[model samples]
Target: MYYVIRYGPAEDNSADLYMDPIPGKKVSFTRGERLGTLPLLTFRKRAGDRGAFLDYLGSSPPCMVVSDRFVEALRSVGVDNVDFYPAQLVDEATGKATPGYQAANVVGLIACVDAAKSVYTLMPGLPEGGAIPKNGIFEFKSMHLDYTKVHGAKIFRLFETTSTIIVHESVRDAIEKAGLRGIRLIPAEGLDAFY
Candidate 1:
C-alpha cells in the first residue's frame, strides 16, 4: 500500500519553520528534476517562539528538507528513488546555521493514479472555452493509484500531482521504526476522509 506523507501537528507556542531557496538560487526539487549543484536555502523560523528542530521540514512551492536520520532510515530500507543535496537550516532570528539536514528530491515521475477510481476535478483551460487539458495537474479530492504502474516504487512524486509525495508501506514502517519526527503517514485510501 502507498501512503501520503505530511507534516505532523505543530507544538504549542513553538515556531513553525518553513524553508525557502535563497534569492537567485534556482530550485527544481518539486518537479523531480536533478540539481547539478547544491542550492542555497534557509529555514525561516517564526519569531519569538521556542520549537525543537524536526526531522522533516517543508518548504514553499512544496519541497522537502529532511534530517540526516531520515535519509539514513530510507536508505536502510533500500529506497533509491530519492536524491539528497546538502542544505543548512539558518535560523531567521539569530542567523545561526544548523547542519545535518539535506534537501530531498524524489526523482522520476510516475503517472500511476487510477483516475477512474480516484475523485478529482480537472483544471480549467488556459483560454476561455478552450479544451481542458487532461494532464497531471488537477484538484484531487481523493487519489487512488494504479499500483501496477508503481512497480514497487518506495517513494515518488505523483505525475498526476507533482506536489504530492507518495511512499510505500515499507518506507513508512522504516520511518516509524526510526522514531523520526515531523512526519505523518496517511493511508492513501483514507485521503478523502482527511480532505
Candidate 2:
C-alpha cells in the first residue's frame, strides 16, 4: 500500500490543524491533478523568511524532545513522531502570506489510513502552554479529534507534566518496553516508506 501525505490546516473549535490547504479553498497541488484532491495534502511552508510573525517564538526552537538542552527555559516534556508529508520549498520571490510560519525542524509524525493521512497533534503541555503567545502555536491548540476515525503510526508524547524538558517518544517507549514486556509491534507505517 502507498501513502500520500501533506501538512494542511483545518479550523477546529479549539485549534486549527494544518496539513492541507486552508480547507475550503479550491487549490491545486504540484504532485498531480489526480492526487491534488487528496485531503491531507500540504505544501511546504518555510520557517525562515524576511518578515515572519510566528518567528517571534524564539530564534531557534529545539529540534528533538530529548538532548540539545540549549533552549533557554522551555524544555521538552515529550516527543511524538508526527507523520507529515515532506514539504516542498516554495519558489519564494513569489507566493502570498499566511498567518502561520514555516515548518520547524521538529519532526511531526503523520499517519496514513485508507489512503488518507493525519497529523498527531495534541494539547499543549505545561511548557508548550507557557509559550503560548497572543497567538498560540497551532500544534498547541489542535487536539486530536475523533481519534477513532484516524489510523496510522502513533507517536506518544511523554512529558513530566510539570517540567519544560521534553523526552523523545521512541526512547520512552523503549524504556517502558524493556525488562518486562511481551510482543512489540513495530509500526508497519507506510510514512517511513514514503521517503
Candidate 3:
C-alpha cells in the first residue's frame, strides 16, 4: 500500500507561516528531475507572517522543506531515493533565521496509476488513449496505483502526475514512528479532492 503526503493541520494559537523562494532566486526542484550542483536556495516568510516554524515548511508548488530530524528519520529507514539540498528560511519582519531545514526532492518517476479504476478527467483536446495521458493535465478526483509497476520503489512521483508524491507503507511507518510534525498521510486509495 502507498500513501499521499500532506501537511498536518495547524495547532491552535499558532499562526501558519508560508515560505516562498526569495524573489530573483533560481529554483531547480523541478517535479522529479535529479538536480546536480543546486544553487543555495533561500526562502523567506511571507510578509505579515509571525509564527513557529514547524518541522516541515509549506511552499507553493509543493516543495518539501524539512528539518534535520525529518532527514535523519528517513535516512534511518534506509530511504535512498530522496536528495536533500541545503536551504534557509528567514523572517524578514524580525530578521530571524530558522535553521536546520533542507529542500527535499524525491527522485524517480513511475507511471503506475490505474486509470481505469481511478476517477479523473483529461484536459480538452487530448485523446483517451491509454492508462497514461501524454503531456496533458489530468484533474484527478480519486487515484489508484498499479502496484506491479511500482517495482518496489519506496518513494516516487507519478509520471502521469509528477506533482503527486507517493510513499510506500514502510516510509509512512518510519515517519509516524519518528513523530515527525507538520505531516499527514492519506491512504492512496482514499485520495479525493486533493491536489
Candidate 4:
C-alpha cells in the first residue's frame, strides 16, 4: 500500500476540527505562487493532561494511508495502493471529542499507518495503541508543526529507504525551512515535475 501525506490548508471550519483551548497563530506558507498564513492547529491541554502521537506510536502507529503523475507515475510503476488521511483533532485515548491534537501530528500518524500497514488502524481520532481491520491504501491532509518531528523523521527515513515521499510544490519552502529533506516536490495540478 502507498501512503501519501501532504501538508496543505484545512478543508473546512478549523475551529470545529481542532481541539486547542488556546488560540492558534496564523502561520504563513505558500501553495504554488500564492502565499498565505494558514491557521496552525494546536491541541487544547489542561494542566495535567498529556497525550500525543508519540504515546500512540510508542506501541503502534497512527492512521495508515496518498496521489497525483504523481498519478501517472504511480500508475506507470504499478503503485496503486493509496489513501489520504484527514487532519483532525480528538482525544487519542477515548476516541471522543476531547481536545489537544495538532494537525501535523495527525498527518504524521497517518503516515505512520501507511509506513507500517501490517497493523490495523483505529478510528482516526482513537488512541494509537489499538487493533482494527487491515485495510491498505489511504490519502490524508495535515498542517505543519514542530511536534511532528519525531514521527516525521522516522517516516521520512522509511520513505528514504523503502517508499517515496512526494511533497506538494506549495509546501516545499516551508518543509525546507523546517529542515525536512529527501522529499519530491511537485505541483498540485500535475505531477510532471518532481525534485
TM-score for each predicted model, relative to the true structure = 0.84, 0.20, 0.86, 0.18
lDDT of 3 at 146: 83
lDDT of candidate 3 at residue 72, scale 0 to 100: 88
lDDT string, candidate 4, 1-195, tens digits: 122343222221112122333255432111111212335333322333353322111111211111121223323433333322222344544555433222221112222333232323233554554432232222223212222333323222121112224332233444445443223343322122111
- Provide backbone clash counts, one per model: 0, 23, 0, 20
| Tens digit of per-residue lDDT, candidate 2, span 70-174 | 121112323333222223223234554333232223222222122223232233542422222321222322122223433422332212111111223443344
Model 3 per-residue lDDT at 76:
79
The best candidate in terms of TM-score:
3
* Highest-lDDT candidate: 1
lDDT sort, best first: 1, 3, 4, 2
TM-score of model 4 relative to the true fold? 0.18
Worst window of 10 by summed lDDT in candidate 3 = 12-21
RMSD of each: 3.5, 17.7, 2.7, 17.4
Candidate 1 lDDT at 88 equals: 78
Candidate 4 weakest ten by summed lDDT: 55-64
Q: Over 4 Å off in model 1, which ranges?
A: 11-25, 49-51, 126-137, 193-195
Local accuracy by lDDT, each model: 0.75, 0.26, 0.74, 0.28
lDDT score of residue 106 within candidate 1: 92
User: How far in Å is the alpha carbon of 55 misplaced in model 2?
Assistant: 16
